[model samples]
Target: MKIGLYFGTFNPIHIGHLIIANHLAEYSDLDQVWMVVTPHNPHKQKHTLLDDYQRLHMVHLATEEYGKIKPSDIEFKLPQPNYTVNTLVHLKEKFPANEFALIMGEDNINSLHKWKNYEYIIENHDVYVYPRLKSGNIDPQFVNHSKIHWVDAPVIELSSTFIRESIKNKKNIIPMLPAKVWEYVEHNLFYRK
Candidate 1:
């Protein structure tokens, strides 16, 4: 199987995430796209994050109906401050028969040098990159890199932070979230701030 790993906190899974995953699965060489739900990111602030399991559940809910996209909590079992290189190593050991690629946004590539063992990732794995709104054009150097594959995905301006704040302020995010996730969030009151 050809799998692409899309790592994120997914504080709350929204339509933008789903769209990107779907587009990658369809357009890239990947047969499937797994949203590797990060339990804890060493680089991001902790207070704004939802519980790991909670975030995992929301991703599952958002991706339930999609056959090509899967929600993964593999990082939950790995070490804290999870790094992509560590997860990649674990994944390779666990699934030796599958071909895996790293999927990321241009924003990630911009600061990728800061990531632990990022060079190993760039050399060994195929990096599928999607454009991010307001990031200006991707650096020409990266655009011409041999390992990087740029995918043309629709840029949805909505973000989980924006969605959470909207919900906290009593705004409707129905269109911005997956139907099941929106219903689940409404029923459970997960992000009431």
Candidate 2:
């Protein structure tokens, strides 16, 4: 089976994240999309992150109804400061029968070279990149890579940071996230001080 690994912290999984996963499963050759819940992303700031288990639970709540979309806690058991290369290596070893591909935004692609062992990832795994609003053209270096696949997905200007701020201010996030996930956030007071 071919799977697309959509890696993120998912402090709270939003509609945008679901939309992309659904689109990938429906339109692409991928049979499923696993939302790889990272404990800590090497490239991102640590202070803004929510507890790993809480974030993973939120992803679970958001994707519960969709069989094709699964919440993965693979990184939770891995080493600290989660790196995509290491995660991919581990996944390849464990799920040898499953063909794994990387799913991410074009904005991240611009900075891909800075990631740990990025060249190995590009050479070994296929990458499905969705466009981010205001993201400029792809870098020439990345374009030369045969494993890159660009996807046309709706650009929703929602970020976990923005959602966290809204929750902190007692603002409505119903439109931005799934109802079940929104309820989870509210009931748990996830981002509230």
Candidate 3:
């Protein structure tokens, strides 16, 4: 089976995340899209993140009804400051029969060279990139890679950081997240300042 590994902090799962996953599953050749819940992304700041388990649970709640969209806790057991190449290697070893691919945004493409063993990842695994609103530039090296494919999905302006801030200010996030997820966030006092 071919799976797309969608890695992110998902401090709280939102509608935009779901939309992208659904889009990839429905329109792309991927059979499944796993939302790999990262404990801490080496590239991102830690202070703004929620607890890894809580974020994972939110992903579970948001994607519970969709069989193709799975919530993964693969990174929780891995060492801190997760690296994509290491996660990919571990997943391949664990699921030998499954073909794992990388799912990322065009914005990430710009910084591909900075990631650990990024060249190896590009050469070995398939990459499915979604367009980001402000990510106008793409790395030439990424463009030259044979395994990379660009996917077109609606570029929603919503972001987890914005949603977190909104929740802190008691702003309505009904439209930003799934109904069940929103309810869970409210009940759990997520993003409360």
- Model 2 over residues 57-176: C-alpha lDDT tens digits? 889889999989999999888978768899998999999999999999988899898999999999899999988887787889888678999888777678888988988898987899
- Quote each prediction's TM-score: 0.93, 0.93, 0.94
In model 3, how large is the Cα lDDT of residue 71? Answer: 97
Query: What are the per-model numbers of colliding residue pairs?
Result: 0, 0, 0
Identify the superior model by TM-score, candidate 1 or candidate 3: 3
Query: How high a TM-score does candidate 2 get?
Result: 0.93
Global lDDT of each model? 0.86, 0.88, 0.89
In model 1, which range of ten residues has the least summed lDDT? 134-143
For residues 1-193, what per-residue lDDT tens digits would candidate 3 score against the true structure? 9999998889888899999999999999999999998786566766768778888888999999998999999988888776889999999999999999999888888888898998889888999999888887687777767899998887866899999999989898799999988998888887888
Model 2, 42: alpha-carbon shift in Å?
A: 11
**Model 2: per-residue Cα lDDT at residue 123:** 89
How do all the candidates rank in terms of lDDT, highest first?
3, 2, 1
User: Candidate 1 has what TM-score?
Assistant: 0.93
Error of 3 at 167 (Å): 1.1
